[model samples]
Target: MGLRIPVKLKHNDKEVEVNALLNTGFETDEPVVALPLTIASQLNLTPGEKRFYLGPGALVGEVYLAGEVTITVKVGESERSIKAYAVIEPREEEIILSDRAIAELGIVVDLKHMKWWLV
Candidate 1:
């Protein structure tokens, strides 16, 4: 039960907007972003969706940035830009911000204030 924030994903200069919950349980050094078949095709990306155990519920994830690209996090007043490790497959859902993303670009998730800060 955490907050779900609207996040944007960009590839090959195209952007897709989606919502994702702020999660600490997601373990990955690389950022995980999802893209649908249509978007992936637009960016010339072909990948597979991964199904794995996330706590108790099986979490299916999409991959992007396998070849290196840009990923940006846009919160209310703050925006952080970073490199994408990969995009998710079957991209029907939102994008999940990886810890590597937050740490690299100095993204501050102000849980108390309900705002994201960047410095």
Candidate 2:
């Protein structure tokens, strides 16, 4: 299993805590978090425009650029927030945290133990 961490996502006045996957392969220069349509809706985010993109393992897909939101990673008493661009797709079922997001949140993942801690 992959490393998953509790994260609180906020947009405007709406927010929700979810188990977000820490995907090291989801590389991007800027902080990005991929959310399902349901989460996007709950956050009151409207899908703005469509974009063609490449994903992990060189997979190709289309996703909606649902603007930006504040992503806060919560672990015990440590928490950090970063403004990230939200990628929403109809078929997405999990919140995928990009490599940039993880680094921005000061997350150090111990894949051997499947554990994570904030720095």
Candidate 3:
């Protein structure tokens, strides 16, 4: 039901690889990504601010903005990196790629064929 991309996150010299789903509905002013609390713990990320997350349907709750995180992804033949805010959701098990993040990464998603490529 969504586009998934490989994501590499680095924080405090700790690096981990995970798959993030591209969420077109996620509208944010900054380029950000949402990570599970467990994964954030692995990166030793620090919380910044409290925010509310609205999920599919009526699911809505509070989440912590887990400071700054480095997101690295390969675009075309080159690798790109950007700093993004990480929202830590204790109950979330999947990584979400926000629209801002997608713009920064230059990822092109083909919804008609259900595929994605780096531009």
Best lDDT among the predictions, by candidate number: 2
Q: Candidate 1: which pairs clash?
A: 35-91, 62-87, 62-88, 62-89, 63-86, 63-87, 63-88, 64-86, 64-87, 65-86
Clashing pairs in 2: none
lDDT of model 2, residue 55: 66
Question: What does candidate 3's lDDT look like per residue over 1-119, in tens digits?
Answer: 87788889988889899988998788888998888988898899866688887778998888898888899987567788889988897777998988999888877888789888777
Report lDDT (CA) for all predictions: 0.58, 0.90, 0.85
Candidate 3 Cα errors over 4 Å, as ranges: 53-59
Model 1: per-residue lDDT, tens digit, 1-119? 45566656666766666665555455566765445556556556666445443444675543434344566666567777777665544545544555666567676677777766667
List CA RMSD, all candidates: 4.1, 1.3, 1.9
Q: Choose the strongest candidate by TM-score.
A: 2
What's model 2's TM-score?
Answer: 0.93
> Which ranges of candidate 1 are over 4 A from the true structure?
5-7, 34-44, 48-67, 74-79, 89-92
- Model 3 error, position 40 (Å): 0.4
TM-score of each: 0.59, 0.93, 0.88
lDDT of 2 by residue, 1-119 (tens): 89888899999999998999999988889999999999999999888888988766788988899988999877677778999999897788999999999999999999999988989
